[model samples]
Target: MTWPKKYGGQERSFLDRYVVTEEFRVANAPVRAHFTADRQSGPVLLKYAADEIKKDVLPRITRGECCFCIGMSEPNSGSDLFAASTKATKTDEGWRVNGTKLWTSNAHHADYMIGLFRTSPSTEENHRHGLTNFLVDITLPGISISPVHNMAGLHEFNEVVFDDCLVPNNHVLGEINGAWKQATSELAYERSGPERFLETFYILTEMVRTLGTEPDNRSAEGIGRLVAQAHTLRRMSVSVNGMLQAGMEPVLEGAIVKDMGTVWEQALPRKARDLTAFTDIGNRTNFDRLLRYAIHIAPKLTIQGGTTEVLRSIIARGLGLR
Candidate 1:
């Protein structure tokens, strides 16, 4: 509730917001209803969108009445956002977008999408140039959404195709052909959130419960290590949030938190599985089921937001190694 008085928010500090996010993740709250909007899209709009657009969208977002999806990754350009082929051509009516976006989470249910489209052709000297961000209304005509089921048997992702979808000029999100500048700052918000490290946390919690107060040395050691890792990542995430609140873009720090956090989260399920292997809990079926589900969904932890390889490259560039 703490956003800002102007945007229908409570104007809470980043630290306060971090507390809410951590509580939600630890409890496995069903926040999918408004997760993306609250986490990244709302802030992006507040920072770079037109005033009218902000007045239209920010209130609804704060009310949890609107959902948003990002439209950056295409079939041809997953990590290399500069290679996006989705074209947004200038028109008297506005910008007409025509292209496909893959792995668009919640596109099937999202009320809006913050899309990155090619506004001009990339020059050899600047491959990252020529991209533009748009606030696309998913209800607009000529847009098609098809489901992409994951290994977990969930239809949480979709392939969104835009065929001459018209967006008003007022919906343009920042400077035309300069979205790359805006993108890095936005990604820092995404990469450093608690979700980066907490996706598979339920499995660890369940294992601890199954192990009970008295655990073997091996089980105790495994649980201790997992707790330590989770605590360290939480500290890193909070530190990044502090940087963001100070109006500084800690892209390198965000990338490092995401890189290390996702790696640990992806490996957490397997580690929990091993820890629970020799457990003698008589009625631990629930724990077993959750562990299985965690294992199924664990593979995507490092792939989403940004892939491990992409995050490492950003970190390297920030460190002056690239």
Candidate 2:
């Protein structure tokens, strides 16, 4: 995937595009390495990774020099992100962060972390107002990252421990305790993409292969239904991207994309399991490995970007819920 050339630095949505179909699935590569950089870190950095940070870190993201991980989840807080407990204190040299962060996917290999921290103590009226975003170096002193294996049988996720680690004031993103405002835009980038709905696309192709021009009613009907749902998700995702490019935060639409994408992603595996009924069906079809992997890993997709339950709350709020 060559970096699309920037047209006046407004390339988030460059209109017409042609990406490889499911044929690219069999060539599955370890995207976890660049997951944070491309997915989360890039958007945030375009705003905050200034000067030296941009020169030193941005270019290396493509060459695999700077790996990144999200720091929103915590030992005490997962879906309820306002419940985060990690703290960053002002120090003479910089800010010193402390506390443990849970469900920090791929932190072990991350060069930098876009972590959430408490810049100011939370108050009754300021519960979600004290959190801030920081770009912390995992290599900084007093910082440690440990792997947390996911049920998908992958070691990409990790737990990051911050024990008095130093992060210069330059690392602070947005304003102090103004993370919620930053998140409205940050999440637009996070939620407005095709990756969420298309992770299991490999197996979707595999099902097509197994059917081989002729299929049963169950398979035929299911495939058509899945295709229509996926197409709808893609259009919604593209619309959100258009909103993003227009310099507006499509919060409600973003929540919808994530919620629908995750739901459809979760369905891919159950459908695959039905199509494939063997522990080891290598000899039975060309898609056995792909199907097996999808069946095991599909469930994690919903929870990875955000859990189904958590995202639904956002959707409900979008619908005017308190």
Candidate 3:
């Protein structure tokens, strides 16, 4: 997929291609459209960065030469996003980053990483201050990446260690330590994507297949509910994308979609657990394995980018909070 020059481009989104149920389009189509460039790490490079980064990153993605990953979370930090311990110190050479990042998807294969770190200490509340972002190279000498075996025993994630890694002065994103503002924008991008909820969607497609010629009430009802839910969530997701395109931060709505969509993905297996025997161990528990995958991965959906609790905090504040 060629990367878009501007995130919220005037051209129709990439997701316009899929023939999804109309409802899904309303809830989350934009997310599906910008899953890669718009949703993940693309924005920081686009918004806070200079033109050179864009020039290199854009065509590289179009040519399939660039891969991306999130660099947040560690053994101890999960829900307390602001509590991350990774430190990036300013040095004459640039910034020397040293710390470990956990559950980093695509870490093993990605060419660049958008890392979260403490550039200084908080001046305001502990939540505010000292945080920053950097576009780091995985091939740098001080970096080490190892895969983390998952539920299906799949090597999809990795543990990334940065040992005094060097990031040139230009690599610093936004201000010296003003990432909190930047993070608000980045989280909106991360939380609004389709990947959060579509990881195990193949099961639903399989259910439609297993029903064969005519699905009974249970099968039809089950599939219909999922299809409808996917539609609704998708529409909401698309709206978020539209908002992002407008250069507005739809953080609260994005949280709502991720929290709700992930819940629905988790529910898919439970709703179909008894509808089919294909869930046998040999079949990867079509339900059991997917259920396992969704469950294990589900927590990360909320935790990744930002925690569900943190999202609620944001939402609650929107309702009325100090």
Best candidate (score: lDDT)? 1
Q: Judged by lDDT against the true structure, how good is candidate 2?
A: 0.74
lDDT of 3 by residue, 1-322 (tens): 2135453233444344222323343343333322444345665676776678777675665455677787877878767666778889988888898889998876876888888888887766556677888888789889999999876666767999989888878877788677777767667656766665675576676666656657777777777888999888878877786787777888888888777877777666656555664423234445455455544654444455566677778888877774
For each candidate, the alpha-carbon lDDT, in order, equals 0.90, 0.74, 0.69
Runs with alpha carbons beyond 4 Å of true place in candidate 3: 1-38, 124-126, 277-302
Better of 2 and 3 by lDDT: 2
Q: After best superposition, candidate 1 residue 159: deviation in angstroms?
A: 0.9
Q: Give the range where candidate 1 is weakest over 10 consecutive residues by summed lDDT.
A: 1-10
Compare the candidates by TM-score and give the number of the best one.
1
Clashing pairs for model 2 are: none
Q: What's the true lDDT of residue 85 in model 1? A: 94
Q: Can you list the residue pairs that collide in candidate 1?
A: 2-10, 3-10, 3-11
Task: State how far residue 108 of model 1 sits from its true place (Å).
Answer: 1.0
lDDT by residue (tens digit), candidate 2, 32-138? 67766866786687676566666667667756767888888998898778888899999899998999998777787778888899988778986788998898888
